[model samples]
Target: MKIMSVFGTRPEAIKMCPLIKELQSHTEITSVVCITGQHREMLKEVLETFTIKPDYDLNIMKKEQDLFDITLNILDKIKAILIKEKPDLVLVHGDTSTTFSTALACFYLNIPIGHIEAGLRTYNMTSPFPEEFNRQAVGLVANYHFAPTEQAKKTLLAEGKDPKSIFVTGNTAIDALKTTINPNYTHPILEWAGSSRIIMITAHRRENIGQPMEHMFHAIKRIVEEHPDIKCIYPIHMNPKVKTLATTILGENDRIKLIPPMNVIDFHNLLNKSYLILTDSGGIQEEAPSLGKPVLVMRDTTERPEGIEAGTLKLTGTTEEEIYKQFKLLLTDKVAYNQMSHATNPYGDGFASKKIIEALLQNKKD
Candidate 1:
């Protein structure tokens, strides 16, 4: 069976790379990878980390590329590959434009789609900004819904998706940790963050870009000012606007380092060393807990609620006051911090790739 795995962006690459390797190893399946390069530079690091040289590179990244640009560009470029290979299944992950557009193209080509990390829902489309809509849209056409948790599968069932088509394979984010985390890993950042509590920052959600983003920054800035024993390292996003805001607000603090994005290995190592994680991102919510680091999500909602339910995450929302209170509590209250850090991860057991393959291969005969 021929299977094409299509993904773009750092989160997708990190999660998909492990699954791609498993697909390649499955004797019954011929795995092919196509990258949309939704995140060119950040995506590259993960691809290299996994040793995945893509069969196709759309190279769609541009200056100030919007959702329309990414969607249309991937649609135009990926159609030809679909036509040529005509794979038995086109696999897409999560709710990125690359996932939705590629799945849409496969739908047009009459090829089946297998959605990884499927059935996550915030219900509110405006909060996650297009992601909620994207995943739901993928749900509409997906033949196989590879949900990462039982709760996610329940979301699919509630949405009226076929029970026969849904597979409760745990999140591939946990699977990725097997490859990323290393005890011997060391970097200058770790050295600088030595002995002091490292508060890792990764806030670049589309909805949190304006006042919400400023609020998040102000809260972090205040926390840094008050807590002299801790160092905050913000490996910022590639978006120029995000960089400008991050610099203008979170800069000037010698303890706060606004570094460019690090590779997956470095990022994972940093997370492993971090005392706390503050983010508006999704992947970090899952990854940090496995490393025994507590995460404070600076957003109103999250699709991956299992982390919060498992006690590893606290949704602080995008407000200066609320974020400060939660963050400060985690730092000051060792009991609160330990409870979160020691909580078992509800995401996966590092076998999501194999489970996804088993389910796919079982159904491939259809």
Candidate 2:
């Protein structure tokens, strides 16, 4: 089987690289990797961590690029590659412009698409901006839906996706964790944090950019100020607005360290060592639970409701008061913290990549 796996962005690369490695192990499968370069430097970090050299790089990233730029550029560039490779199946991960645009190109060429981490939904399109729209649009045309959980499979069924087409493969994010996390890993930041409790932060959602983002930062700032023993390390996103806002609110605090994004290995190890996490990001909701870290999701709504139900994540919406309340509760209440930390991760074991490849092989035989 000639299978082309298409993805861009750091999160997608983290999840997809494990599956790509799985694809390469099978003699019958020709694994082709194509990166859109939607996230450039951050994406490069992950690819290097996994030692994945792409067969094709779209290199479509630019200064101040918007959804229109990403969508149009990917649509224009990936079509020719699809025409040339003409793989038996094209796989896309999650809901970036890369996934949507690449799937559309495959649709145009009559190439079957297998969507990894599929069937996730917030239904509130405006909250996650283009991501909610992107995933739903991909669902409409995907030949196979590799759902991360039974909840995701249920969502796909409710949306009228074919029953036989969906498989409840555990999240590949967990699969990536198995490879990257090192118990003996040490970094300068870890030394700086010393005996202080580490609160790892990642907030770069498009919808949270302006005032909502400020609310999240302010809440974290309050927590850091109140707690002398805890230190915050926010690996700031590449977005300039996020950089400026974060610097303004969180930069000067001695307890808060606003640093550039770390590679996946460092980031995962940091998450492993952290006392807890705070974010408006999607992948972290799944990733943190596996590491036994309690996550405070600073968002109005989340598509990953499984994490909330499993008690590993708390949806503390984007507001200064609400975020402050939740953040304080987690710190002060040991019972609450232990309950969240010990909660069973509903995402998956560490073999989602193998399951995904098995599904493809079975489909090929059938």
Candidate 3:
């Protein structure tokens, strides 16, 4: 069977790379990769790291492209590739404009689509902006839903997706960790963290852009000031707005190291070595728990509640006081930290690629 996997952006590339490799391992299957290049330059590093080259590159990225541009560009260009490849099935991952657009184009062509990392829902469409809507839109048309957890499956079931079609395959993000977080991995960031309790911070979400971002930054700043033994490594995202805000608020702190964006390998390795995590991003919510790192989610509402219930994560939201209090308590209280860090990862055991492949092959036979 020939299976085409379509994705854009670094997160999608990282998560999908494991599954792509899994598909390649089978003698009976041919894995075809198509990149929309929604995140052209940043995505190349991940693809190179994983050693997965594309049979098709849409080159859809434009300078300062909007959501509408990405969606329409992908929809227009991918149609030709889908027709030419004529894959047995198409797989799209997570809640990106590329994911939704690829799924929608497949729907228009009446091709079967398997949604990787399906069934995540924030419910409030505007909070995550279009991502919440993107996943929901893909859910509407996806022939197979590879839900990462039971909660994700429940979301699909509640939305009336076919029972047989929805499989709790665990998160592919964990699968990516197998290749990414290596024992020999080294970085300059690790040098600064040293023997101190390293807190890896990543906070840049559309919802948390202005005041919310400031609140999170201030809270981290407070924690660093109060805790002399702790050090932080914040790999700031590429958004100029986020960069400016981070520099202004977190600038002069010796303990708080504000660095540029890290590739998946570096980021995952950092997560593995870190004592704890604080983030507003969706992917880290799933990935950090598997590393036994306690996460203080900086968002008000999360699509992944499995971590919270399992004691691996805490929702501190974007409020300055709330964020500060949680950070302080976790740092000072040994029992609280241990409980969160030692919780069994509900996300996956890093076998998600195997499950996703089996589902695709099973459907192919049917």
TM, every model = 0.98, 0.99, 0.97
Per-prediction CA RMSD (Å): 0.9, 0.7, 1.2
Q: Spell out the clash pairs found in candidate 1.
A: none
Cα lDDT over the full model 3: 0.91
Give per-residue CA lDDT, model 2, range 243-327, as digits (tens). Answer: 9999999889988989999999999999999999999899999999999999999999999999999999999999999999999
As a TM-score, model 1 comes out at: 0.98
Error of 2 at 61 (Å): 0.7
lDDT of each: 0.93, 0.94, 0.91
Per-residue CA lDDT of model 1 for 271-295, tens digit only, reads 9988999999988888898899999
Of candidate 3, the 10-residue stretch with the lowest lDDT total is 356-365
Residue 56 local lDDT, model 1: 93
Sort all candidates by lDDT, best to worst.
Answer: 2, 1, 3
Model 3 misplaced stretches (Cα beyond 4 Å): none
For model 3 the local lDDT of residue 321 reads 100
Worst 10 residues of 2 by lDDT: 124-133
